[model samples]
Target: MRPIAILSVLAGLSALTSPAASAQDRPPRPPAFASPEVTAEKKVSFRIHAPKAEKVQLSSSDLPDAGRGLDMTKSDEGVWEATVGPVVPGAYRYSFNVDGLAVIDPRNPATSEANNNTFSLVYVPGSETSDAKDVPHGAVAEVVYPSQTLQRPRRMHVYTPPGYEKGEGRFPVFYLLHGATDSDASWSTIGRAGFILDNLIAAGKARPMIVVMPAGHTGPFRFGGAGGVSFETQMAQFEQDFVKDLKPYIETNYRVIADREHRAIAGLSMGGAQTLNVAFGHLDEYGAVGVFSSGVFGITGGPNGGAPDTRWEDAHKSTLDDAELKKGLRLVWFGCGKDDFLLKTSQATVEMLKRHQIDVVSRDTVGGHTWLNWRDYLVEFAPLLFQGK
Candidate 1:
């Protein structure tokens, strides 16, 4: 062996056996991956490395108190880390408070799936939809219809029942409404209305019926307007827009059952008021009505309470009266959470209907007026439609 080569080999071996090794003598090891697990019953830890930041904080909407705010400490390579304790999962919306500016976790790629800027979800154990298996589900689509009332084209979304696009069978239709400060996209985006219906239809709980979601806000109120003042006029305009323009377009474009017996209407909050004003008043058009949270009449029976005083005929001059409601209406189903701001209004509407000998299926829950409550209401309500022979 050459003396130089032998000496080099001996030095390398000596370095391995010695307490310290030369700078070039050691080989690099691979980086380590983080293995973190969480359960629904217990809390989970989350760590983020952001070493250069001056201050870091964590905030979550689900937590009663502000989330654990971490002051990041620098590592050898100038990386900062923030660690927080276990949190109950179920799609927790959280953001990092970096220097007082809220930010989503850049290291986490899953938050990108939602396409939301300020919020991210953490799926905990035992979520109903999270736990459910992939089954045959319905489809949702965005569609545009011509509107003569607004003097422009209108856009809306529809969720077709399972086997609808493929099969030759005709299906019933339900026209759903969204609340104020929300658009036609609200139901599909936040509520997951299509997914909920798909699950129900797959389980045979709901009939194969087409679901339509429409924007109920009209005029300046659409952008942002207060109730009691702009609501009546705006609501009236919405009714006209729905009946004169939207309805005809849907009938022409889709293979929907056009008769009143095959059509229904429902909504949440401001949309709920629209549901009652439009569906009940125009019972000749919509056979069934689902009223959630908001109602057309308040308990006081005054002009702004919920329903009109004296009689509904005087309040809604052109629409049908109570006697007509009894003749044309098939079902009036209403639900609201006990803690909802609109609870009293919903109760008053129910009493007014019942007093006029109108039958109703009323339900109440314990949640505040929130999307989670509404989603569950839909999960329950979808099955009740088109049940009778």
Candidate 2:
């Protein structure tokens, strides 16, 4: 090397080793590891390096006293730490509340999304149905189609079963729906629909099929809120889009069996109600209906905490009484948690249907209004679909 170049290189090396460079230029090396250290027992240890924050708390769907928040203590180095749970084996969402500000765990990359917010995800493996298993995986696609009814383009998440890209035959379609605050993306992400279906199909518990998760929130919806594009109005608009645009687009674009006997409709929470309205509105199009933790709005009775509204039943009296038309349906399934706020809603709906002589299967499990029950419902319900009985 030339003497000038050698001197310049030496000067740079000297600067890098200088005290000033070590103090200001080189950043503090990151910790050996980061937040969300999961133990074998499923207890999770979480940490955040925040020196300025006076308070930090852990908030998770599965944590004990979640509504009350789990306190996180600070260390000498200003890092906040907390450990919680033998967290149940499933996917969960968690966030750190730093002095009232909600923040996703920076150390965790896996995330679950909702219509209005996002949360960090952690998987507590060992679940038979919901966990990642040694099975053939399916493909989840996000595609958009023009909504002729709404005069706009809309998006949806479609899960084609394993080998669909290479397969040569048509498959049955399950129109899966999400909750009021969830977009079309919820099923494949937080709900883990793809993995659950893959596990089910691989284990011979379910037939391979297409699962379509559409955007159910056509407009704003807040439970117990008065006026301004109520959920009922949004449901009507969604029904129109589903029937006129979304359904036909899927049938044309994908390999779907275009018959009522090969189609099923189901959803959770807001989506469950949508399932009822859309499927019942066109009973000739769907062979099966699955309701998870939901009932007709305002028509809820018992523990739903209000005077039971029978106006909906009174309005649909003729249809409910038409047992002949509904007989064409192969299955009418309903599931709710024992502690779910909508337990009464599910019960009243099932009782009303039974009164009309409709054959309905009701399942009561242990859980509240959450995905724990929804995922379980899907695993239990998917096997019954497209069974040529």
Candidate 3:
């Protein structure tokens, strides 16, 4: 080899054998830390490491004064923290705002999502009924079935009891639903349905039954109206898809007691309206109905829902007074928060039903339109279903 070529070969060999190429070139890892350390007193403390950020805050709908963000104080090491609440027991969605950017706790893996955003989840475990306990847990399944009405496949979440696969007998079903902008997964995740049901079933408070959580947003829905697809049109379409499509699919696929007396339906917010549309209109399908924090929208005092030419009452007047519906329904349950924006609408709904000589159970709670109340409502509602059978 030529002298220059020999030198070049030696340089290549030295570079190949160098420690920098093997190990020293790797970047340093960040310091170890843990977030969301809950104190023994049940206070939730949130932490984040953002060295360059000027401001950080903790945001959560579950907080008592969430409108004013929980201000976090930064340490000399750039770790920011804020502690609040002897908070109520349930799963609450939270996000860390670092210098105006909303982000999840990087140190935490538990999370939940909304239609437009994502959030980290924290469980404050004190409640006997809502907390995930050491019990025979059920299985929650994501099911996709054909929607012949809309010409596409739709998704739903179905929760089967602990021994559903091994058991030979069938179980009654309760159809639960989510509010607007939330998907079918809401009940399983932040809503904590699985845990609640597991504990309830194990404790013999609720019967071992299947819970079906279906997506409620079937069409264009916003605060105002969509261009052509109005709320009534969308709700009507949902009613059709639900009664005609999803019910049949669930009945044929699952091991269910396939009759009205064994089936019930319930929902919150937008879902509450959907529940009314499905259960009230199709009286022969469901024996019990639960409406939480909602009623017919477009009523004058309804929550942010704009005025429609005809409210839900104007449309469902005949159906509400139907003898088959009155006779077939085992229980008509209505629960609304005292501070909920839709309290008046719920009140109107109950009053209207009562005028027609229909019996309804109206429950008034202490919170606003939120998951805190919904969780409690579910615990109370689940035990009441299929009791007459």
Candidate 4:
């Protein structure tokens, strides 16, 4: 057997040699590092155990391949391991691809859930001491509001700007949306919007404001359910939910600028399309709109068709062609990663908007269709959401 295997077996035997040996008497396990270390030179190691699987790979947003990952060498006990090169200190989320299935580390508790795959999060030390409390922090709260449109109680997330608890000032509001595969918690948990915005505000780079992240999944033309709906009908239901139900709840519960100029909507992926549909269709309600890596312009067919039809003509009729969106909208922002599959469609939308004499702030970044890109966009977009309007 290999030297490492021999050492492992010997270590295991050592624990069994003593009748009084407890779980704590065994050798301490290796440190499981996920995020990059903060020093100039840093190394990250990841491991997973799937003995029955023939192949396994480690994937991460900071690395490549949608975090789908690197191959792991199996041990006699069925554990697999891989190490990453030196990286800058920051927080990162990762997962393991076991036989083409993404899985989180069973040992780690810091996780984010959007689907079947839970993420493993790591916080690396940075320029400051790892536990320094120098930075001012904000708080997050998940809220539920009565939805008259859907006839149910809908939940959402709210991020109160730092110093909000000490002041009586009413803040402007930004309604941010998440993609199809995500829920309301994506902005605060996975995207880290609260932290990013708090940093920006503390640095005087951004003004204090309220950000409301609503659940944007709307089912078919049906009234009560919010799932398994056609793309077109889903968009319509989202509009009703936002304008009729969500807006009133925010205006009543939170201290906000309850008018058009103070309201903005932005989202990524399917949520991006929803942003366009909600803000543009109800131009009288929101003065600013943002669509990030959105696949809105191409798609057709109803629920009868496959889930993600790319025929734009059929899915986006009323909202996409509205003239008021161009006339009344104060700021329209569009962003996408240069390497994203939806780049062409984003560019095409910019051209169409320009042809209609509607100006927009178009941005491109170095990323694909991952949350890393979305997190970066949140860092850049939050300050600009309700500023000029």
Candidate lDDT (C-alpha), each: 0.69, 0.87, 0.85, 0.72
lDDT of 2 by residue, 1-389 (tens): 99999999999999989998788977665455478888899888888877789999989876655656788998877789988778778887889999999999988899887766898887888899988888899999999999988888899999999999996889999999998877899898889999999999999889999999999987555664454457767888999999999999999999999999899999998898899888877887889999999987677644537688887678777777777777788899999999988888888889887888888999999988988889899999999999863
Residue-level error in angstroms, candidate 1, position 71: 12
Estimate, for each residue in 219-247, the C-alpha lDDT of model 4 and write its tens digit: 42223334456656667787799889898
Question: Evaluated with lDDT, which candidate comes out highest?
Answer: 2
Q: Name model 1 segments beyond 4 Å from true.
A: 1-132, 219-233, 297-313, 316-325
Task: After superposing candidate 2 on the true structure, give the runs of residues whose Cα lies further than 4 Å from its correct spot.
Answer: 1-30, 220-229, 301-307
What lDDT tens digits, residue by residue, belong to model 1 across residues 73-151? 4555444444444543234445667777777765455441121143544444554542334887777888988888988
Error of 1 at 8 (Å): 41
TM-score sort, best first:
2, 3, 4, 1
lDDT of 3 at 243: 78
Candidates 2 and 4 compared by lDDT, better number: 2
Ranking by lDDT: 2, 3, 4, 1
Candidate 3 ranges beyond 4 A from true positions = 1-28, 219-222, 225-234, 301-310
Collision pairs in model 1: 43-86, 44-86, 50-80, 51-79, 51-80, 296-306, 297-306, 297-307, 298-305, 298-306
